[model samples]
Target: MFRLKTMIGLFAGALMLTAGISQASATELRIASGFGDNHSATRALREVFARKVEELTDGRYTVSVFPNSELGQATEMVNQAQSGINFGVYVSSAFYNSQVPELGVTNLPFVFPDRETAFKVFDGPFGDKFKPLFEKSGLVVLGYMELGFRNVTNSVRKIAEPADLKGLKIRLQNNPVHIATFRQLGANPVSIDGSEMFAALSQGVVDAQENPYSVINAFRLYDAGQKYMSDTGHFFDVIVFAGSKSMLDAMSAEDRQAILNAGRLATEAQRKFAKEDEAADLKSILSHGVTFTRLTPEEREDFRKATLPVYDLVRERLGAGLVDEFLADVDAAK
Candidate 1:
């Protein structure tokens, strides 16, 4: 009994010592984002994180955000973070799918039922599953923010029915799932980097594209040679902030807390801004002379049916069990 009491006291002392040391060692951290400086995600994170991180660290540490390609492209940012050149990135899971294909299961077409359901799953089991994958790749997933449900936008015509997308060359992310979806819909899906999208659409390399309201507005897709938008919310996209596992490991506890605190606060702020952006997307775009096509129930069904192969191919690539786990989350959330 005496030795056990002494050991407990010693463990308590060690914990206190570690806490004190953590409090003193951290200073500041840099965060990288792909969203433009004025974008909702970037602006909200930079503004909210700076204040929240300092407070969480008791001003022992701080966060500085670099938005747009200020630090670099999303893929480049992830590579940089993984290599421990810098810290995290506000990137898409589709971007991470190049390194971790199973993670892309979240981005499958018509998978998520709504935004609320999306937040729950990504913040719950599904998000947890990707953490180790990110860590194995030398990256650490902090958490997720929002990009919201995506709608198809085109210059050629409004897409009220699946037939409308036929023959339209659309810009797609470099992923098999997205490629399969567009191809099944009878459109030629052209894989293009996010950075190249504007120019590609402008030069007519692709006649249409799809993204969340925030993204379309941030890059001025409406003015960038796009004429019509479709309210076909086919998929949900989320921006993930993943840090360098090596860099995080090197951080003192206070600094680590600072990064996570900032991330949580940023998620809230980004979500609020994203909600507003989505609410106002159609009205705002119409003011710029853009047209929106709202699909009827039957038309939407037609759109959904066209992408059946997306499910088959994605499940095959992800394997039965992983795909089942993903669909379970999707169903639970739905």
Candidate 2:
């Protein structure tokens, strides 16, 4: 009986040692996003991206997702990822423009005629040229996901022409190119953070704002008294999925490859979700009694023409050579 009790004690001790080793072998990567939980990008990150990473890594790696600015605002979250406080971040391309001003080339109004042309440019040589810029800022480009084309929403009136936007105070992202584009169209552009947008609209701090249908619906901007929406499609926005270079470098090659593969899959899935959700999101927004306007080709051309000097403004800010190359690339892609 004494021998048997000693053997049982030894067995239990071995089991505890094994459990500790198993726990220590697993690594948890935290990914942060400014988008709300309901946003398709957030959903893709949680469902497709996180799941694939765990599966591909054979449970050696796990992901923790914090959405809706739980980690921090978009730019702050990007800083966390850069510093390795968070393992990765999914943020707007516009947010990265401060660090890589060349990225502003992508934010130029009407640069991409449609989604297909945009994808071709980003997935090909143009993207190859820009990826290094992001890497220099301590990020490894995982993949680019679609944020979709931006549309105008307002409490004031329907926007069918450039003159219709005259004197309207529109909330815009803190991007110089975007602000310049709106200013060219005769609206007063106010830079407000995403978290404050609904309140700003509701309280009349701004009469108008621009975002994709997904954002307006997810944030319920209609409830904020925004009764007019126009399919401006001014800028084809992109969401960049990036990992910390420092943190990724610390990982084994096999582990790093697993993360990259997961990111690619997640980005593809996210783009699909964004495209699929747009029509439904628009229908939902219209159901809220928001007036909608779909600009004809001629009307869109007028807005595009009014903002033409923005291209020159971009050239002045980002250099004519780079902007010219980008335009050539965009034209070639088409």
Candidate 3:
């Protein structure tokens, strides 16, 4: 009986050693985003990428996701990825304008007629042009996740024309292009972070804000006294899924391929989720008693014209005529 017990102890020790080796062999990656844990982007990363990457890499790699800006703000997360610390971040193309101003081209108002056109452009050759731009800033562009078309929400009134937005204190992301566009439309656009948006809207710190329907619903902004929503669809938001270039470069070819494949899967999942959530989100917001307005074609055109000077503003900051050339190319391709 004593000899049998000793043999069992030896077997348990060997099993423990094997488990330790297996755990140490897997490379764990950290992915962070500002979206809530239940947000589609977070779900895609956790469900689609995290679950598949290990299998895709034959158990060589795994992922951990941090949502709700737990890792840091979007800008801080981008900086972490740039430093090659095995970090991935879901940020906006508008945020990239700070690192590479020309990337702001993707954020231009009314650039794409609709989400379908925007996705085709981003998934095609046009999106390829920005890869090197991202690499130059120490990031590997994994995929472009959809944020959908941003619209306007305010407590003041329904915004049907450019004049309707005048003098309203609106909260916008800290993107210069966005600030300039809103300034042109005559609203007082204040740059603020996402985490502070709910309070800003609730406390009268800002009377208006703009974001995708999903985002507006996710943060429960409608409950914060925002009474009106207009489907301006001014800027089609693109969430950039990215990783540290150096870390990606250091990986073996097979591992890199696995990462890319996982990213593609995550992007597909996010886009699908965004599409499905939009209508549901809008419905939920309506249930909160917020009035909705679908912009008439002429009213949308008024916004388009009002913000046209933003192209020149972008040109002056990025380079002369870059915006015009980019838009022309996109139009010709379409």
Candidate 4:
């Protein structure tokens, strides 16, 4: 069998294209994502990937995206994808970090300077090194996209320094690394799904929660009666499009490239969604009457200084070389 790379953009393209005339073949792949309708991040990926895939594959392959967890919740989608009962899952790295400890590296506080640096590190060294860790666990990572940088919104009074974080029970995703990072930083971390977080905060089950502006704004955490907010890019959420390794291996080379291209298209759209929405999202919260406490550089450093030991945590599990490779590449990219 000739590889598609050799067939593309040549006279051989005609011969290569003739092999796929089966009407009985699988026409659609199932894709699950957790973003609520109208949310920027989820909207970008769900709509863009589906459209790009249909175009790229010339309608032979379709991706039916389940947005708003209509099929099942995002966390459960992983196991489904792994079983090949589902084709792919749109999941946050935070959720998978507990299962594949190497991913805990992403949850480390103050790791990347900002959102751009975060993605650069992930797309280059950090994500490259960590992609195989998923393969080892029977999954193939299609690609990484941004959920935007997370910030803290609390019902507590204004937060200005590390001491301000004390005793606030912030809801975190159910993962050890998320809990550990918050614990080390002095907040009482409450583990829960993002779907439940706004209500948990509203009813006093939690005093605060952390998420990207898109999420904070979309979930209407501010409307839930929160008062104070902090920009704590403590960690970056790399939305990973992943699925069964074997299923991907079973794909025809063209289908494999189509899936990969869709993931990239989704990322390009997701990044645009995040970048364009950042300013408006935060401002929208203010209009909803949530108070903002923008952290000065000194305050941010205070938080970073306290949580700096997380390097040991990441280096121990993910290898010092991994972090070094990540840091060097990100520095150059920045």
Task: Give the candidate number with the greatest lDDT.
Answer: 2
Which residue pairs show collisions in model 4?
none
Per-residue alpha-carbon lDDT of candidate 3 for residues 1-334, written as tens digits (9 for 90 to 100) = 9999999999999999988898798888998888888788888999998888898888888899988888877788888889966469997777776566777877888888988888877887768888898899999888899988999999999989999999999999889888988999999999888888999999999999999988899999988889999999999988999988898888899989989999999999999988888899999999999989998999899899989999887888877766676787668656
Residue pairs in steric clash, candidate 1?
none
Tens-place lDDT per residue, model 2, 39-78, is 8888898999899999998888889999888987888988
RMSD of each: 9.1, 2.4, 2.0, 8.0
Q: lDDT of each prediction vs. the true structure?
A: 0.81, 0.91, 0.87, 0.78
Could you give candidate 1's per-residue lDDT for residues 229-249 as a string of tens digits? 988889888888787788778
Instruction: Tell me how far the alpha carbon of residue 19 in candidate 3 is from the true structure, in angstroms, after superposition.
Output: 2.5
Off by over 4 Å in 4: 1-26
lDDT for model 3 comes to 0.87
Judge candidate 2 against the unseen true structure and give its global Cα lDDT, from 0 to 1: 0.91
Q: Report the error of model 1 at residue 206, Å.
A: 1.3
lDDT tens string, model 4, 1-334? 3666665656566655654544235377887877777765567656888788778877777777777777676678788887788888777887686457777766777767877788777777557877787888778887787786778888878788878888989898876667777888789998887667767988999998888888888888887768888887777777877877877888789987887888787878877877888899888988987878888888888888888777777787679986776667767868
Clashes of 3: 0
Candidate 4, overall lDDT? 0.78
Each model's total of backbone clashes = 0, 0, 0, 0
**RMSD of candidate 4 to true structure, Å:** 8.0
